[model samples]
Target: MTQIAINRPCPPRRRFGLSLLWDALSLHRQRRTLARLDTRALEDIGITREQAEAEAARPLWDAPEFWQK
Candidate 1:
Protein backbone atom coordinates (compact mmCIF):
# COMPACT_ATOMS: atom_id res chain seq x y z
CA MET A 1 0.00 0.00 0.00
CA THR A 2 1.09 3.58 -0.74
CA GLN A 3 0.21 6.79 1.11
CA ILE A 4 -0.32 10.19 -0.45
CA ALA A 5 0.59 13.56 1.11
CA ILE A 6 -0.83 16.96 0.42
CA ASN A 7 0.65 20.42 1.15
CA ARG A 8 -0.94 23.88 1.03
CA PRO A 9 0.77 27.23 0.57
CA CYS A 10 0.43 29.98 3.14
CA PRO A 11 -0.94 33.34 1.99
CA PRO A 12 1.49 36.25 1.68
CA ARG A 13 -0.57 38.46 3.99
CA ARG A 14 -0.64 35.82 6.69
CA ARG A 15 3.09 35.26 6.28
CA PHE A 16 3.71 38.99 6.62
CA GLY A 17 1.54 39.14 9.72
CA LEU A 18 3.40 36.22 11.28
CA SER A 19 6.70 37.90 10.50
CA LEU A 20 5.55 41.05 12.27
CA LEU A 21 4.41 39.05 15.29
CA TRP A 22 7.78 37.33 15.47
CA ASP A 23 9.55 40.65 15.27
CA ALA A 24 7.47 42.04 18.10
CA LEU A 25 8.14 39.02 20.30
CA SER A 26 11.85 39.16 19.57
CA LEU A 27 11.94 42.87 20.37
CA HIS A 28 10.14 42.27 23.65
CA ARG A 29 12.63 39.61 24.69
CA GLN A 30 15.60 41.75 23.72
CA ARG A 31 14.26 44.74 25.60
CA ARG A 32 13.65 42.65 28.67
CA THR A 33 17.22 41.42 28.55
CA LEU A 34 18.47 44.95 28.10
CA ALA A 35 16.49 46.10 31.12
CA ARG A 36 18.11 43.39 33.23
CA LEU A 37 21.65 44.28 32.22
CA ASP A 38 23.93 45.84 34.82
CA THR A 39 25.61 49.20 34.31
CA ARG A 40 28.88 47.47 33.52
CA ALA A 41 27.23 45.33 30.91
CA LEU A 42 25.54 48.34 29.39
CA GLU A 43 28.85 50.14 29.33
CA ASP A 44 30.46 47.16 27.63
CA ILE A 45 27.82 47.49 24.93
CA GLY A 46 28.59 51.22 24.71
CA ILE A 47 25.02 52.18 25.67
CA THR A 48 24.45 54.56 28.55
CA ARG A 49 21.98 53.73 31.33
CA GLU A 50 19.58 56.36 30.00
CA GLN A 51 19.72 54.86 26.54
CA ALA A 52 18.98 51.41 27.84
CA GLU A 53 16.09 52.75 29.88
CA ALA A 54 14.69 54.53 26.87
CA GLU A 55 14.95 51.38 24.73
CA ALA A 56 13.31 49.30 27.45
CA ALA A 57 10.48 51.80 27.72
CA ARG A 58 9.56 51.51 24.06
CA PRO A 59 6.56 49.36 23.12
CA LEU A 60 7.18 45.92 21.65
CA TRP A 61 5.88 46.94 18.25
CA ASP A 62 8.05 50.05 18.12
CA ALA A 63 10.88 48.40 16.20
CA PRO A 64 12.52 50.02 13.21
CA GLU A 65 10.69 49.71 9.84
CA PHE A 66 13.55 47.80 8.27
CA TRP A 67 13.08 45.03 10.84
CA GLN A 68 9.73 44.16 9.30
CA LYS A 69 11.42 43.32 6.04
Candidate 2:
Protein backbone atom coordinates (compact mmCIF):
# COMPACT_ATOMS: atom_id res chain seq x y z
CA MET A 1 0.00 0.00 0.00
CA THR A 2 1.18 3.54 -0.86
CA GLN A 3 0.10 6.91 0.57
CA ILE A 4 -0.86 9.68 -1.84
CA ALA A 5 -1.27 13.47 -1.34
CA ILE A 6 -3.55 15.70 -3.39
CA ASN A 7 -3.53 19.48 -3.78
CA ARG A 8 -6.80 21.42 -4.16
CA PRO A 9 -7.36 24.80 -5.72
CA CYS A 10 -8.31 27.55 -3.32
CA PRO A 11 -11.61 29.38 -3.66
CA PRO A 12 -11.59 32.99 -4.81
CA ARG A 13 -11.60 35.66 -2.12
CA ARG A 14 -14.55 38.04 -1.82
CA ARG A 15 -14.08 41.47 -3.34
CA PHE A 16 -14.11 44.56 -1.11
CA GLY A 17 -16.69 46.15 -3.41
CA LEU A 18 -19.34 43.65 -2.28
CA SER A 19 -18.80 44.62 1.36
CA LEU A 20 -19.10 48.29 0.48
CA LEU A 21 -22.41 47.67 -1.28
CA TRP A 22 -23.70 45.71 1.72
CA ASP A 23 -22.66 48.50 4.06
CA ALA A 24 -24.44 51.07 1.92
CA LEU A 25 -27.63 49.05 1.88
CA SER A 26 -27.47 48.58 5.66
CA LEU A 27 -26.93 52.29 6.18
CA HIS A 28 -29.94 53.09 3.99
CA ARG A 29 -32.19 50.78 5.97
CA GLN A 30 -30.96 52.14 9.30
CA ARG A 31 -31.51 55.71 8.22
CA ARG A 32 -35.00 54.95 7.02
CA THR A 33 -35.82 53.37 10.37
CA LEU A 34 -34.35 56.33 12.21
CA ALA A 35 -36.39 58.76 10.13
CA ARG A 36 -39.57 56.83 10.94
CA LEU A 37 -39.03 56.98 14.71
CA ASP A 38 -41.35 59.29 16.65
CA THR A 39 -40.05 62.17 18.73
CA ARG A 40 -40.77 60.26 21.93
CA ALA A 41 -38.84 57.28 20.72
CA LEU A 42 -35.97 59.48 19.66
CA GLU A 43 -35.99 61.16 23.08
CA ASP A 44 -35.83 57.77 24.79
CA ILE A 45 -32.56 57.22 22.97
CA GLY A 46 -31.38 60.72 23.95
CA ILE A 47 -31.42 61.88 20.34
CA THR A 48 -33.34 64.92 19.11
CA ARG A 49 -35.58 64.79 16.06
CA GLU A 50 -33.30 67.26 14.31
CA GLN A 51 -30.30 65.07 15.00
CA ALA A 52 -32.11 62.05 13.66
CA GLU A 53 -33.11 64.03 10.63
CA ALA A 54 -29.52 65.07 10.05
CA GLU A 55 -28.33 61.48 10.30
CA ALA A 56 -31.10 60.19 8.09
CA ALA A 57 -30.31 62.83 5.51
CA ARG A 58 -26.80 61.48 4.99
CA PRO A 59 -26.10 59.50 1.78
CA LEU A 60 -26.31 55.71 1.89
CA TRP A 61 -22.55 55.29 1.39
CA ASP A 62 -21.69 57.94 3.99
CA ALA A 63 -21.26 55.48 6.80
CA PRO A 64 -19.03 56.11 9.81
CA GLU A 65 -15.38 55.02 9.64
CA PHE A 66 -15.95 52.27 12.18
CA TRP A 67 -18.41 50.57 9.85
CA GLN A 68 -15.64 49.96 7.33
CA LYS A 69 -14.13 47.44 9.70
Candidate 3:
Protein backbone atom coordinates (compact mmCIF):
# COMPACT_ATOMS: atom_id res chain seq x y z
CA MET A 1 0.00 0.00 0.00
CA THR A 2 1.20 3.54 -0.80
CA GLN A 3 1.06 6.28 1.82
CA ILE A 4 0.11 9.84 0.85
CA ALA A 5 -0.03 13.09 2.80
CA ILE A 6 -3.44 14.73 3.17
CA ASN A 7 -4.02 17.99 1.35
CA ARG A 8 -4.51 21.08 3.44
CA PRO A 9 -5.74 24.61 2.76
CA CYS A 10 -3.03 27.21 2.32
CA PRO A 11 -2.73 29.98 4.88
CA PRO A 12 -4.25 33.29 3.98
CA ARG A 13 -1.82 35.94 2.71
CA ARG A 14 -1.54 39.24 4.47
CA ARG A 15 -3.54 42.06 2.90
CA PHE A 16 -3.46 45.84 3.42
CA GLY A 17 -5.41 48.84 2.21
CA LEU A 18 -3.76 51.78 0.53
CA SER A 19 -4.73 53.81 3.57
CA LEU A 20 -2.75 51.49 5.77
CA LEU A 21 0.28 51.94 3.59
CA TRP A 22 -0.15 55.70 3.73
CA ASP A 23 -0.52 55.66 7.49
CA ALA A 24 2.65 53.62 7.96
CA LEU A 25 4.56 55.86 5.58
CA SER A 26 3.25 58.91 7.37
CA LEU A 27 4.39 57.44 10.66
CA HIS A 28 7.87 56.93 9.17
CA ARG A 29 7.96 60.55 8.00
CA GLN A 30 6.80 61.73 11.40
CA ARG A 31 9.58 59.71 13.01
CA ARG A 32 12.18 61.30 10.78
CA THR A 33 10.87 64.80 11.53
CA LEU A 34 10.79 64.06 15.24
CA ALA A 35 14.34 62.77 15.16
CA ARG A 36 15.49 66.07 13.70
CA LEU A 37 14.09 67.86 16.72
CA ASP A 38 16.43 68.61 19.61
CA THR A 39 16.30 66.46 22.75
CA ARG A 40 14.45 69.17 24.63
CA ALA A 41 11.84 69.39 21.88
CA LEU A 42 11.31 65.66 21.96
CA GLU A 43 10.99 65.72 25.75
CA ASP A 44 8.26 68.35 25.46
CA ILE A 45 6.28 65.97 23.20
CA GLY A 46 6.81 63.05 25.61
CA ILE A 47 8.65 60.99 22.98
CA THR A 48 12.24 60.06 22.25
CA ARG A 49 14.09 59.25 19.06
CA GLU A 50 14.12 55.60 20.11
CA GLN A 51 10.36 55.59 20.51
CA ALA A 52 9.90 57.17 17.12
CA GLU A 53 12.23 54.64 15.55
CA ALA A 54 10.17 51.84 17.04
CA GLU A 55 6.98 53.31 15.67
CA ALA A 56 8.49 53.79 12.24
CA ALA A 57 9.71 50.21 12.16
CA ARG A 58 6.18 48.82 12.55
CA PRO A 59 4.86 46.94 9.48
CA LEU A 60 2.44 48.71 7.17
CA TRP A 61 -0.11 45.97 7.76
CA ASP A 62 -0.02 46.88 11.44
CA ALA A 63 -2.24 49.89 10.78
CA PRO A 64 -5.80 49.60 12.06
CA GLU A 65 -8.59 48.74 9.58
CA PHE A 66 -10.33 52.04 10.09
CA TRP A 67 -10.72 52.32 6.32
CA GLN A 68 -13.14 49.39 6.32
CA LYS A 69 -15.75 51.66 7.88
Q: Write one digit per residue (lDDT tens) for candidate 2, span 1-69.
A: 999777987776654787768878888999999999998999999999999999999987678987645
| Candidate 3 residue-wise lDDT at 43 | 87
TM-score of 3: 0.43
Work out the TM-score per prediction.
0.69, 0.69, 0.43
Per-residue CA lDDT of model 3 for 1-69, tens digit only, reads: 999886997775554688557777786677567657777887898988788667656664555465344
Report the candidate with higher TM-score, 2 versus 3. Answer: 2
Tens-digit per-residue lDDT, 14-54, candidate 1: 44677667878888999999999999999999999999999
- How does residue 50 of candidate 3 score in lDDT? 84
Which residue runs does candidate 1 get wrong by more than 4 Å? 1-15
RMSD of candidate 1 to the truth, in angstroms, is 5.7
Sort every candidate by lDDT, greatest first. Answer: 2, 1, 3
Model 1: lDDT of residue 54: 94
lDDT of each: 0.84, 0.86, 0.68
Ten-residue region with minimum lDDT total, candidate 1: 10-19
